[model samples]
Target: MYVLDTNIISELIRPRPNGGVVQWVDTQPLSSLYTTAVTKAEIYYGLHILPMGKQRGDLEQALHQFFSAGLQNRILEFNSTSAMEFAMIASYRRKAGIPISNADAQIAAICSQHGFQLVTRNVSDFAECGIEVMNPFTE
Candidate 1:
């Protein structure tokens, strides 16, 4: 299974998205892909912060398409297991001075807890978190 990061979701909605990401996603079954609650919240926060304009409109439209176009069922929530995983990862990172943000930790926790390979453009941020990560933007 694959868990999509926020940036990857943004790429999918772009008019000219990253070709590597597009191709990789196209070849995979939709059921194998998922978006975590962390990612969803980030996307929504981004859209909401944009000024009222065409850019915002476009982003909003793309976001709607993302949810409505058969990707809705894959949104993973922050359940008890996810929370426990988050606590563990967050505590470890803090003790190790890794300085990982809460959102990224939550996303990584969900992915790790579920044994999902994370798909993201920000590959380095998730390194050493004990989960497989694939950078679709890479060659």
Candidate 2:
């Protein structure tokens, strides 16, 4: 299984997303992709900050569809296993002088706990966290 990061979902909802990512996603079986609840909240958080307008309305609808697709497939939730992974990853980053936000840590934790490869554009950010990451936006 694969974990769809927040940036990946954001790219998909944008007016013009990375063609490589779009193509890569299209070629993959929908069942192979998954997103954490954190990603969904991130999308909604972005939409919430947008000024009221047609653009926001459109984005809201797009987010609804994006979430619906994942819901049908699976939306991984944070659990005990996730916490164990998070503690290890967060502590390691701290000891290594690497700074990662709580949200990013949560995403990484879920991926580690489930052994899901994370698909994202920010490849370097998730590196060294003991989670597999893929950047489909690359050539």
Candidate 3:
């Protein structure tokens, strides 16, 4: 199974999304793709901060429909197992002087707990998180 990171989700909603990313997503079974609550929060936060306008309105509608239709049952939560994974992963990275944002760590934790590969554009951010990561934008 693959968990989509925020960047992948964001790209899918773009008016002219990357062809590579779109192609990659199209080849996967819908049931095999998932997103985390952390990604939801990130997407929502981005939409919330945008100034009210046609762009925002369009994106809001697109995301609403996408989540409701495409990912209703595929949204993963950061449960107890994820939290423990976060603590371990975050602490290890911190001690090693690696700077990973809390959100990325949380997403990584969810992926780790579920044994899911992460689909993201920001591959380096997740490099040492002990989860398989694929950059659909590039490969």
RMSD of 1: 1.2
TM-score of each: 0.94, 0.95, 0.98
- Reference-based TM-score, model 2: 0.95
User: What's the candidate order when arranged by decreasing TM-score?
Assistant: 3, 2, 1
lDDT of 1 by residue, 21-134 (tens): 999999999999998988999999989988999999988987998887758789988889988998888888778888789999999999988999999989888876878999
**Looking at candidate 3, what is the lDDT of residue 19?**
99
- 7-91: candidate 2 lDDT, tens digit per residue: 9989888898989999999998889999998888888998999999999999888888878864565889988889989899988
TM-score of 1: 0.94
lDDT of 3 by residue, 55-94 (tens): 9999999999989999989999999989999998899999
The window of 10 residues in a row where model 1 has the poorest summed lDDT is 65-74
Per-candidate alpha-carbon RMSD to the true structure: 1.2, 1.2, 0.7
What lDDT would each prediction earn against the true structure?
Answer: 0.89, 0.88, 0.94
Q: Give the TM-score of candidate 3.
A: 0.98
Model 1 per-residue lDDT at 125: 89
Ranking by lDDT: 3, 1, 2
Give per-residue lDDT, candidate 1, residue 5.
95
